[model samples]
Target: MAGYVVAAILLFSAVAYFVGRAAGERFVSANGDQVHSLPGYHGAFVAVWVGIPALILVLVWLSAQGSVIDGLVLGGLPADLVAGKTPSEINLLLSEIKNVAAGHIFSEPTPEIVAASQALLRWDEIARWAMVVVVLAMLIGTMFVARLRLAPRFRARTEVERVLSWLMIACAVSAILATLGIIVSLLAESFAFFRMVPLHEFLFGLRWEPQIAIRADQVAGQGAFGAVPVFVGTLVISCIAMAVAVPVGLYTAIYLVEYADERVRNIVKPLLEILAGVPTVVYGFFAVLTVAPAIRQAGSLMGLAISPNSALAAGLVMGVMIIPFISSLADDALRAVPRSMRDGSLAMGATRAETMLKVLLPAALPGIMGGILLALSRAIGETMIVVMAAGLIATLTINPIDSVTTVTVQIVTLLIGDTEFDSPKTLAAFALGLMLFLVTLALNVIALTIVRKYREQYE
Candidate 1:
């Protein structure tokens, strides 16, 4: 692996050198004007094409070669040595065989395994050398082809820029496709869940008590599939989070964009980002140690019995987590508003506050709404703070100060230990994941739609 990595790096470097030379090439045309673009772009274009495909081939070859070689070597081993083993045992035997070949397996070994190991090592080594030769040949051929194409009107620069754009689009497509793939996979699993527990029961049932008997003789309570209790908890916490984040974050953005001096914005913006940079686990601890206790004390003072792990605590910390999202988006949206609007408002004797409230904010409302959608998504999907701060009981309640669980926390609980793959407990996580995906997707779609409508109105 190390040798392959080193060889791949060298091949990439060589490709880069050649491609750079081709991209920015220039030659005086008949009218004495310089060529349209430099030759470096041409070089880059060839490099990207050559290196990309060959690198892909190398990776595929590397991944498949071991399994192909192993199958051949293992098949050649004596039947008695390989027979009667489970698939996992067969894998273990194969690993031992490899280790023996490499002189690392530390137990008494059968001659058949030793022989198989030797054969595998020999073939693996041969395969590596063959790959090295083929890849080098490919690199050389591509370089030769590129040099042949290096001429006055190669148009390499345009081709390279086009490739770069397509590459970025491919990256974005991958992200979207990955999200879609996850949703599909979860939907499949959740469909299985719905088959076991009816759709209406899972969606509207008010109690969530999941327990299944390990053995036929073992006694267990009927597993209730009602998700309403958790459904309500999730809603309450999310609303509290939004309530906290929106006012504070929007005000912060307004202050930074319309009120604060440049130096304060410079300092404050990074500080808010720093808050966003803090890991969720750290926030979880913050909720458990600081926020949860504070809420409990405050609840006590108010003559209320607030659980240590309550919705309010989780929601408040989540609001802190989401503040950066809204503030940053709001700031950008506010900045994008034309200066003329603020000037016009001011000329009419509107104060900064009045102008921001009446003109700038309304004009930037779509973008602000987009940011809130993003923040809402964050709140919905948050796991750590809620897991730590919200107690793990799914009850149908709307009180923010009561102990309750969210979907993420339940998913985490359902799958945290040694679990059977086919159990309903494990499948529940995927069902919850599907629901979360659909919800977040709906919010994002709405946000984009509103923003688009706002853009058209402005235009």
Candidate 2:
């Protein structure tokens, strides 16, 4: 019903736009030079009034109606059915009633439950129809009112601009609030984790076991929260990835910008960027089914021991995944340098290689560094490739052939099952997340500082 109402509102809004535009055109034909705003602005103003208010009403109504109906149904239930029930128990009962009402009954329900389900269904129908009526009335009434007010001096453009400005402000505020909310939640959960596990043990302890006995008789490892190994693994993998990606990506960008002709640039750039569009999961599969085995074989031939799931495999795949990010950004940065600089260098008898190496590289250093940092962040946060190719044992070793786990992989492992949120095991994920966020945030700040310093010098 709500969907139908929205469709009706959209159809009517389109009609209102054309009608308002025709009205504005008519006024212009009659009172030639007197109209304040263009006919398109008048149409937009009318369409905004026609759609936005009605849509907002529908949205608010739909958001609220389910809880309101549920409350009313629960209140109508017999007191004996709900007496002495805790909030969780009551919520479960309500869910059962809703399921029975929707014909998903797994067992027979009592008389009171049946009656409550009937009431729920009836109230839902009533609320949906009421919403539809109210939304339609608002749409039609606002359309008429806005059309009546459309005059030569209506200032429709000013009104439309004000609405758009407010919309943008609302979007920006919502994004900021969401980010703040995430930080606050992470801090709260991480604080809970720190209370349960000491900060020093988590930060400096050598072991990484997180298993804890949930019941007295259950067999489990003594919980260990030392995160040093996880942190080290993350650094080793990221470093390996950057080792492969930075030089290759930068060289590719240099070739594209300084040497390649238009046709070659067009073909090669797209083919290179297609790597970025490939899903990370596909890269994970490639690492596990292909790269890891090949690395193990190569290690065997060299009389070296290599884990089946090794950091080298994951790092190589991840580096390939990140090449496009560095390449594209570096390409854009190199292109953004002034053509006059290149011309002047050539006129000064400098070879193209000398001009590029001596002048263009330094000028574009900021953007290239920015891309490297971005790719580093991407490498650190990647989970699937690491999980598949890098084993989950958080070993404190830097050997690329040895298996190790990263912070992201540990966070995922800790939160994979039906775990209690209040448990240290579960809360540990939040602590890891908070750490990841801080690292990424620091990288971004550093990138911005570098960009700003170089940008000032160049400008």
Candidate 3:
């Protein structure tokens, strides 16, 4: 029904645009050179008026209809059915009522439930139809009013631009509010987790076991929330990945920018960027099935033991995955260097390598640093490859051949089942997330500082 309303509004909006455009054209013919806005602007103004308000109304109705219908149904039920019930119980009862309405009955429902379900369905249908009628009426009403306002003097372009500006503002505000909401949620949950487990233990302790036995009699290890190992593993793997990615990616960019001819650049750049398009899961598979085994075999040949699920395998694969980010950004940055700088250096009798090393690289350092930092963030937050290639042991070892876990892997492990939300185990995920957020934030701040410092020098 909502879809039908939206479709009708869109169809009518098109009609309104044409009608308003015709009206604007008529006004122009009647009073040539007096019309302030173009016919297209008039048409867009009419379309915005006809569609946006009605679309908003439909969205509001859809968001509110279910709750209103549920409340009405619950209110109409017998007092004994909901008398003194807690909010959770009431919610469960509402869920049952909805399930019955949807014909998902597990057993016979009581008469009150049956009657309430029927009322719920009836009210929902009525509300849906009412939404359709109201939206269509609004579309037509706005269409007529907008058409009536069309004249030689109406500033349709200004009105349309005003609406567009407001729309953009709303979108920006929504994004900011969403980010604030996420931070607040993470802070709240992390506080809950800290109440159950000490903050120092979570931040500084050396273990990462998050399992807590639900029953006192059950034999389970006392949960340890120390996150040192997870943090160390994340750092180690990211360092290894950066070690592989930065030099290779930077060199690739240099070759493409300075050495490759037009044909080679055109062919190689796209092929190199194809790495970014490959799914991470495919990389994970390559790590697990191919890279990990190869690493283990190579280790055996060297008379050293290597874990089958090793950090080295995950780090190598993740580095390959992020190569495109560094390569593409660095390529753009290197290419953005002023041609005058290169020509001046060459005119001073400097070799191409000397010119590139001394002039182009220093000039593009800020953008290259930005790309490396972005890739570092991507490496730090990666999960699938780590999970598939690096085992989830949370071992506090710097050895790339050792199996270790990262913060993202731990967060996934902590929240993987039908767990109680209020439990320390589940809340631990939020704590990890908060720490990860802070780490990434710190990285961004450091990157910005470096970029600003170099950008000033280069500019």
Candidate 4:
């Protein structure tokens, strides 16, 4: 029904646009050279007037309708089920009623539940019908007013541009608000986690066993919130990733920009970028099935012990995954260097290698640093490769061949299954997330400082 209403509104909006455009053309014809806005502008003005208000009406109705129906249905239920129940319990009851109403019954419904489901269905139908009627009326009335107001002097373009500018601002504000909301949520939950587990333990202590007993008398072990091992694992993997990605990606970019013929360059560049398009889960599978086994066998041949699920395998695959980021950014940066500089270096009798090493590289250092930093962040935040290739054990070792878990892996482990949000075990995920956020923020600040310092010199 809502879909039919939207389709109708769209159809009417299209009609209104043509009608308003015709009206504007008529006014221009009648008044000769007195017209201000174009016929298209007048059409757009009519479309905006018709569409915006109707969209708002539909949005408001859709947002409020579900809650209003839920309240009405729950209110009409037996007082005992609605009263003195926890939010989770009430939500579960609502879910069951919804399922039964949708004919997805898991079990026999009580008479009260049956009656409540019937009431819920009836209210939902009535609300949807009301929404359709109200939205259609809004579309028609606004469109009519807009048509009556259309004149050669209406300034439709200005009004349309103003509305569009506000929409852009609203979108920008929404993005900012969403980022702030995430930060605030993480902070609040981390604070709750810290109240249960000390800040120093989370940041400094070496152990990271996050299993907590559900009840005080339960035989399950106590939670240890120390995060040092997780942080170390994350650092080791990111370092390994950067070590592999930076030199290889940077060199690949150099070869493409300086040496390769156009045909080879074009072919190779896209083929390399195809790595970026490959899903991270596919990389994880490749790491687990192929890379990890190869590494283990190689280590055995070298008379060394290497874990089957090791940081080296995950980092190697992750590095391969992020190569395009570094290569693409570095290529752009290197290519951004003036051809004049290269010509001048050659005119000064410098070899290609000398010119590349002394001139182009230094000039593009800031951008290269930016690309490397991005790759590092990608490595740090990755979960799938680490989960598949790196073991769940939170070891403090920095050995790439050792099995270790990262902060992201630990967060996933902690949040799985039925979780009590208030428990330190679950809240620990937020605390880990907060620390990861801070680490990344610090990396960005440092990278910006370095990049800015060098960029000014180069510029």
- lDDT (Cα, tens digit) per residue for candidate 2, span 1-459: 877998999999999999889888987888889989889889999999999898888889989998999889988988888899998889989999899889999999988888888898899999988898888789889999999999988899999999999989989999999999999999999999999999999999999999898878989997999999999999999999999999999999999998999999999999998999999999999999999999999999999999999999999999999999999999999999999999999999999999999889899989999999999999999999999999899999999999999999999999998767789999999999999999999999999999999999998
* Of 3 and 4, the candidate ranking higher by TM-score: 3
- The C-alpha local distance difference test score for the whole of candidate 4 amounts to 0.91
Whole-model Cα lDDT of every candidate shown, in order: 0.84, 0.93, 0.93, 0.91
After superposition, the stretches of candidate 4 with alpha carbons farther than 4 Å from their true spots are 1-11, 27-33, 86-89, 102-109, 215-219
lDDT of 4 by residue, 82-173 (tens): 88899999999999999999999999999999999999889988988888878878888999899998888889889889999998998999
Candidate 1 overall Cα lDDT vs. reference? Answer: 0.84
Model 1, poorest ten-residue lDDT window? 22-31
TM-scores for every candidate against the unseen true structure = 0.82, 0.93, 0.95, 0.93
Q: Least lDDT summed over 10 consecutive residues: which range in candidate 2? A: 128-137
Clashing pairs in 2: none
- Candidate with the greatest TM-score versus the true structure: 3
Better of 1 and 2 by lDDT: 2
Ranking by lDDT: 2, 3, 4, 1
* Residue 369, model 4: Cα distance from true site in angstroms: 1.0
By lDDT, is 1 or 4 better? Answer: 4
Off-target runs (Cα >4 Å) in candidate 2 are 80-86, 99-118, 215-218
lDDT at position 78, candidate 4: 82
* Cα TM-score of candidate 2: 0.93
Between candidates 2 and 4, name the one with more favorable lDDT.
2
